[model samples]
Target: PGPLSPSPPQLRAQPQGAMQVGVQARELRQPMAMAMAAAAPGQMVMSAGMQQLAMLPCIDVQERAQWLQEATALLGAEIEMANKYRVLDQVGNQFFYAVEKTDCCRRQCQNGLCADCTSWEVDVLYTPPGGLMQKFLALRRPCSCVCCCINRPTADVIDEATGQKIGSFRDPCTCCSLRFQVRDASDTDVLVVNGGCCCTQPGILCPLPCGPCAQVRFDVEDAESRSTVARITKRVPSCLSWFFAPDVDSYHVTFEHIQNPQWKAIMLAFTIFMDFRYFNVNRNQEQARDVLAEL
Candidate 1:
């Protein structure tokens, strides 16, 4: 028989770096129109202040071979996983990379920033399987202040090349268990984030524990049915990781077998956010001091 059909795209590898884009506020209205048409009777009703948002471009990764090649080139030996990634950037200081949870650069210092510093708006480069190097995603953390500290701090999800606003992850508030929204251009809610516990343990998760470590379940849901599409189990760093070294917070995100690339990307962004919320909360002060001095 002739050669069998090519394998599907392997989406196991995660992208690194980030890109910036120009986002127009008006583009968010399209998805709401589409969603409203499909919403159940009572579900489409919006409150007086509600708004509409756009949906992300449809991304299909079923092509296994192509996806695998891209994953290998970008992640390099790291296993490819959908919706699972570790926070490669540090906190308190600007500039960092969101490396794959499996593949990471161990070099002490590359470029001007060390491997352990917090990153701001880093570009994620990708070439697809047979494509050329292009900006994939950019991680950006906006500065926060005391007044807005308790507010659910959010990270802007920017499309590096076009500077378009693909989507944004609104983190859970520090004080409450309120729902968060993964919004698109029109700020329309694409995925609803609800039902999860936060990681409040101060130290590590080992022999000498500062506090009990619990995994926060970040459940991403559909805007209509409110059914779960993906879930991320996030836990605090270990004692050694928290105090001594810079480590990516431990977490696992799993998506439904058939998923949209846009949603997958949103889930990945959540992982990055969780990393900042958990590990960075217990940031290494000494490291922060040194990082600040370097700036």
Candidate 2:
């Protein structure tokens, strides 16, 4: 995996539903993490937690788009799989490679023994490159990114290296725009991410705070003061990429105002979670559409 170039995901037959995706998300593995940790020991940037938010140069460096581009989203159009992203710094320097992984055995286990696996829990891993090889930030979320108006998407952020629960993101279920509450480990709301205000109560001809547009953004604001402290942005590649491979997109995070490393890590985790929840073209949406067509 070159810094910005990740080989296509392993081609396998993905099942037809979200529950199956959930069955495969867990337990006893870090092979991919191990491999990359050994190979790119030098590429390892400073840790952001106990390591501190010392990598400002790498974090804020020119604010150039640091992409976590999806793995070959279009080598074959119909192949559906977990999301894989090539993380790069603002200058296009490869920093971390991210991918979501699952265990397929549970699909047939039918024995109800896979208690460790939650209904929609997804374990995303990154190593020195892949091998679960090592854990950076382990994120938990629903397998299906798409949710009806009743289902508000939420995600949890965990620091794997330290094995500490950092925080979580919860949606307010606003339909007209995008809004998520960024809460600390205590589940206390600390920051609010607004999708640029579209008014859910009235709700019409309004653009969602999170959309497919190239520069869609969600501003991270302080809960108490309600001041913009940081920002998360979504960027798309060429027109061809968006159409053929909807999952491939770039995300930029700004931390000039908020310097805490733990919160920063939480924000980063949410960015990945948000990408899958808002950007990826996974199985859930396709199945929903099929059901709708049949109806």
Candidate 3:
């Protein structure tokens, strides 16, 4: 599949509840050290330990917002999904992550609060057969970007077992379109995200006639080669669903055809980053106002 622009490809169906899926997350004590010790330059090696932790295969991930108030009550931000969201496969095997924000000011804030005004922390975990949460990928908002709106900040993707960074979500220019670059620890490019339904003009809202087609689409591609690997499509809701439940945006991500296990994790992180940027930057609010005013 290519980018969604030239010709849109048929996307995969969204996965449902986590109750039906069986998920297991193994601890990676020293993922970086093991990766270094196993292979020489120009060669990639997956040790037995890595193979154990990388048990989850590539698959479509579905993320549906629980409710609008539930999100604002937690962080006071205009975010949609601020609680724990589960990533499940077709059969219901699930992995989960909790989105948290800290360093909040006690007084009422302007624009947004918590992650919008402070920092965000995401905890990646998976439940084993016995139902205990195992930590996997941990991410934190970059310090420089937490307070500065002009600076495009990145969220460091850390390996919980070793407490070392394994990758990062690189945000593009704040005035530019909605796009992101995902890179590994070595600063090697992995995935490039080009989000749709975006207004390229800075400080301007989405044009009037585009409201009916206000679906958000993300084209995930190989960063280096620029080949399409996956796609995420969020549909435009009906009029009532839009006005009454504006924040509950559900995204559908497809990655079954992809073979790389690492890519799956990176894509999942990218998915979270998409929401983080959308709410933090106030794009969602702008779009909502535009659509409603037009209506």
**For each candidate, what TM-score against the reference?**
0.47, 0.59, 0.61
Return the number of clashes found in candidate 1: 31
Number of the top candidate by lDDT? 3
Best by TM-score: 3
Task: State each model's CA lDDT, in order.
Answer: 0.41, 0.49, 0.51
Off by over 4 Å in 3: 1-82, 101-117, 145-150, 174-176, 196-214, 235-242, 279-295
Q: What stretches of model 2 exceed 4 Å from their correct place?
A: 1-53, 57-77, 103-133, 142-151, 197-212, 282-295
lDDT digits (tens) for residues 27-113 of candidate 1: 243232212233454343321111110122212111012233223323323222222232221121211124332222321121123
Which scores greater on lDDT, model 1 or model 3?
A: 3
Q: Rank by TM-score, highest first.
A: 3, 2, 1
Candidate 1 regions exceeding 4 Å error are: 1-119, 127-133, 144-152, 172-174, 198-214, 235-243, 283-295
lDDT of 3: 0.51
Model 2 score (lDDT): 0.49
